[model samples]
Target: MQTLVQTFMERRGDLLTALWQHLGISMASLVIAMMLAIPLAIWAARRPKWAEGLLQLTSVLQTIPSLALLGLLIPLVGIGTVPAVIALVIYALLPIFQNTYLGISEIDASIEEAADAFGMSRMRKLFKVELPIAMPQIISGIRTALVLIIGTATLAALIGAGGLGTFIMLGIDRNNTPLLLIGAISSALLAILLSALVRWFQTAKPKRALTVFGVILVLLAGGGAYSAYANRVETVTIAGKLGSEPEILINMYKDLIEANDSHVKVTLKPNFGKTTFLFSALQHDQIDIYPEFTGSVLETLVKGTNPKGMTAKQTYALAKQRLAKQEQMTLLKPMKYNNTYALAVTKQFKQQHHLKTIGDLTRIEGVLKPGMTLEFIDRNDGMKGLKKAYHLNTTAKSMEPALRYQAINDGRVNLVDAYSTDSELRQYNLALLTDNQHFFPTYQGAPLMKADFAKRHPQIVRALNRLAGQISETDMQEMNYDVNVKKQSAATVAHRYLVQHGLLKGAK
Candidate 1:
């Protein structure tokens, strides 16, 4: 509990910013849902025939899984706040719409008759009597919608929409219990707070309720305006895949780029889905720069055939050429580390089988049950190519990245494809088999950017290039260990690396 509290305190600034983003997305979604739903509900209440169909449509939307809804919105709206808000609005509609219809329709018809008998117009009666009488039920619906929005907004982080979800995802990725607790607790509290606020509005006097609503509107508007302004001022947007190393590299790029030119404002958008998403984002101009691997681009993105027995330098050069010619992207100078996939085994298994290289795997044949990530299982350059190149006929099971090491450790699996920089290699005493056949291409880490962005920001390029050959495989593994095993934040680990290397000065 104390550790969680301390973590929250230390990350208060980031948490507050996340909170603001959460509130902004939820409130904007609620407002939009209310605008559309209330009117539709009012129309349905007035005409009993349309109510069933309207409710059915909204119910269908509500039934869609939140994650699926977010995915569905991505191509239409792109990622980040827009798609997130749109999904939330869709999720919020059924409750508010149903309740509004119920509230207004359940009112005593006699009272409405009396207002009509007293010569009051339909709108006047609605304002003076029906709405006020229905206010409590309407407020109840709003409360439900608000709570739902607050909870669901946590998923916005997956789509690069900033929120408390950022910490939650980071915590999961890095195995930081305290950070996860903080994000979960903060989100729960925000939901409770919003629920209470709505309840207060439900019971409060008319003037007080109106004032509270007004204040909320002002806050939402102000937050939206501020976010828009901040985005406008940010000169470079850097994105990265969802992992410790990518997070560290993106932060490094952000820090170095900003330090190189104070006028250049860098926005760090970490955890932007997968490598394919990053490539798409860069192509579409959604992101300016992101760290990528030569092997990944050469084998996957550009669909280029790996030259047999090509040196690491040759692989990088080919990737650079292909990226520029085919995609109009540029690969910057690569770091010393290569994070390519390699087949690994527990030290016990390695010793028992006397396995020193992938060539040795062919001797074991069907005896070795290999576990690999789903991507690697399907990737052309992964297990498929490995089998063809080495003539090994072992069937590999697709496993989650985080669980693969444990599988090997527990003897559930004998071998697994692992990244070169995976900390588990050290922690679990795993041995990487030498790729004597060299089926996997070299994956030297480098910054991939839009050619136009690189051309426009020469200084940023120079600043990033300064990092080339500086970070070694050992350095990357240690940093990953710091975040994953030691429970250190990625930002802290990244900043320490920069300072130790003299790449960044002054306390951040």
Candidate 2:
């Protein structure tokens, strides 16, 4: 409960900003839709032949998959709010246009004739008679569009269009349930409030209520414009590798900077592949920094993928020298934990075969079910490479993370790719096979920053580097246990750990 309150307080800014963006997107889409739809509806109503074709076209646009439509717009429009708004506007059109047509066309012909007989012009008739009568239905359509758009706008986060969806995605990524619930509940409340306002507008005296509403909207528009101008932050993109440990290190820096100075923003651009791909991103300046294994860097990048024999510290020092001189990158202190890959067999399988190491696995290699992620299957240093290097040609089975966990737990798979510090390995009593042949690369975590960035944010560099050589395999597993098994929030876990270790005074 305390954790929940703390998280909410911390994310209050994010919540407000998300709410504002969602409201802007929703209201803007609705207004533009009403403008185009009302006219289109009237024109289509006047021309019977065009009505069917126009409705069909609107339906077709609605039928285009939202994600696919967003993808199609990327080349032309690029990422962020514009493409998100376009997709939402297109989505809003069908219900709005259809209802506008229905509301106007459904009006009694006697009423129209009565208006005409009373010497009213066409424009006057539309305003005094048709529109007033259609007001309820038109507002209903607006209400529907608002609700649907709010829901769909959550997808905008995927394309960097900031909204409540940002929190939702982050929550899922870090398995933070409080954040997920907060995001979902907040979005729901926004929808309900907007829907209620629309319904009230439908019933209330428009001349008075709408006048007041219009004034409020104008003020909001002015305020939004002012806020946008005031908060025009020059974006400093910091991209990096997608490894779990790298993300942890980068997030630490991001939190620190964001807490102390809000102007400079650090954005993570994650590479899904290995050290080589991450280095490539660095060279291209796509990612500013990521935690990398120094040994891999020395062997892979500096030595051209053929580093023969160097101790962990030696390799790291070499990598530090190479990156500083050649690539203009700086390697910070190395963390104690080395998340090198480990092959693990279930306790049952281990006991049955008396297996403790790779040598014992040689006898039953052909019969063993070795579970690996899809990327692991194709990675050069993954399952196939490990097999060639270690001569354990176990029968490989590709499975996702969730499925692999279940497979190993259910004893369906005898061996799997277990990170050295994975909390679940101990939980399930899995026996890690020692790589006697040393097939895997050294994977000690180290933050790699751009040299210029280090110069600017020396304090951030210091804080992160203090964490180096601190987290052991046991420490990380315990942290993961607190986070995943105990279901504590990652930020809370991080803060608590930092406090306990004297890295952050009063952090908890």
Candidate 3:
């Protein structure tokens, strides 16, 4: 109860902000979808010859996976809300188009003849008779499209399109349950409301309501103008990686800098994922700062680590030393979390087998059901290294990386790869095997910055440094528990930690 109250107090602002964002994205998609679909449907209905081809084309788009569609758009349009909107609009077309086509085509030819006999013009007859009859079905199609787009819009977060999806994805990554709940529930509610609104439009006399809607639109246009005028400030563009943590870091930095130094405007241009890409962006001056893993920088970026053995602290120091020579790059202070990997087993299996360390598994290697990702097996410090270091070659099961735990509980696999700080470790009664051999390289979380840029923004360095030496195994476990199991928003939980630790002055 105490935790929930504290979380509510901390996350209320983010929750509200996310709500507003969701509304904006949902409505914008609906409006654009209606505009495009209605015209296309009208054209197709008037010329029945084109209906099959148009439907087939739209259905082909639907066949393409959602993620693939989003990825395909990324290079053409780059990242942010535009690509997301475009994808959602494309996805929304089928429902509205099909409904509109069917609604118009199904109208009785007798009615059309009757209207013609009354000496009405073709346009008048089409509008007064066909359109009115089709309105309900058209509205129903819009409802279906709106619901589909609303759900699909969650994927927008990956490209830095700010919506409830940002919360949900980050929450899942960090194991924050509250955030997932908030995002899921909010998305569901938006869909329900849109569905209800469509029904209401069908039942009620809509001429007056539509007039009011138009008025509201005009009012919003004016309000948007006012907001632009009021919030107008210099823009400080910072480009960097887009990931669960880095996105939040950029957002916080933007808020802090703008609040304290309003004269210096702040804008975020995110190109998320993969350390190599982030470093390249930094070198080209495309990004100002990004959160990076210290050990990853060492092993993957700066200086490759010893494949045999190296402590987390040692790996970090090695990375720091190597990066210090680079004129353009400067590694910032580390974050409170490590985001490292671990090996886990079900507690019952652990107790039954008396397994506590890698050595214990060597004896029963032939019988144990070991599970690991395909990628994990190839990486230098992954399963191969584990087996090489421990001399334990277990014949096992291969499954999807994310579903390893599910495999374990379903009695498919007895041993699986697990992250050191994963939330599910405790929730599922899993026991982490001691990595006494130090097979896995360190993956400490850190802030990497541009050398000259850091000098200009001392406060950014200060705020980040405050996070140093704060995150530990226990802290990470608890945070993961809150997110994955307790159902909290990552932004909320992250903000609370920053404030409680006095890393920042106010809750965001």
Score each candidate by Cα lDDT.
0.86, 0.73, 0.71
TM-score of each: 0.87, 0.64, 0.71
Off by over 4 Å in 2: 1-18, 35-38, 47-50, 69-80, 106-122, 160-162, 174-178, 215-247, 255-478, 485-508
- Error in Å for residue 300 of model 1: 4.0
Best by lDDT: 1
Q: Give the per-residue lDDT digits (tens) of candidate 2, residues 1-508.
A: 7877777898898789888877787777778877887789888877767877889888999999988897787656665677789999999888888888888889999998999999999889888999889878888888888898999888776665667876676665445677777788888999999899888777788697779679758976986889768648654454334333444455555665555555666665432234554565466554556777765566456644545555678767778899888888899989887777778888777888888777677788667888877656765556767777767766678875445666888878878887787767766777788877777777787888789978987766766677778888888888766665676655566666776877665554
Predicted candidate 3 versus true structure: per-residue lDDT over 1-508, tens digit per residue:
5654565567778677666666667777888989998888988887877998999988888778877887687666666667778888888889999999999989998987899899999779778898899998999899999899889988776665667886676555544466567778888998898788668767776696697568756765665587579658635555445333454456556655655655776666543434554565466554567667765676556644354466667767777777877445777666556676677899998898888887789878767888876546655566766777788766546654446776787888888887677667777888888877666677777767777877887876775565667767677677757755666544566677667766667756
Candidate 2 TM-score versus the reference: 0.64
| Candidate 1: 10-residue stretch with minimal lDDT | 272-281
* Cα-lDDT of candidate 2: 0.73
Quote the positional error of residue 409 for candidate 3 in Å: 7.7
In TM-score terms, which candidate is top? 1
Sort the predicted structures by TM-score, highest score first: 1, 3, 2
RMSD of each: 3.4, 6.8, 6.0
lDDT of 2 at 326: 82
Ranking by lDDT: 1, 2, 3
State the RMSD for candidate 2: 6.8
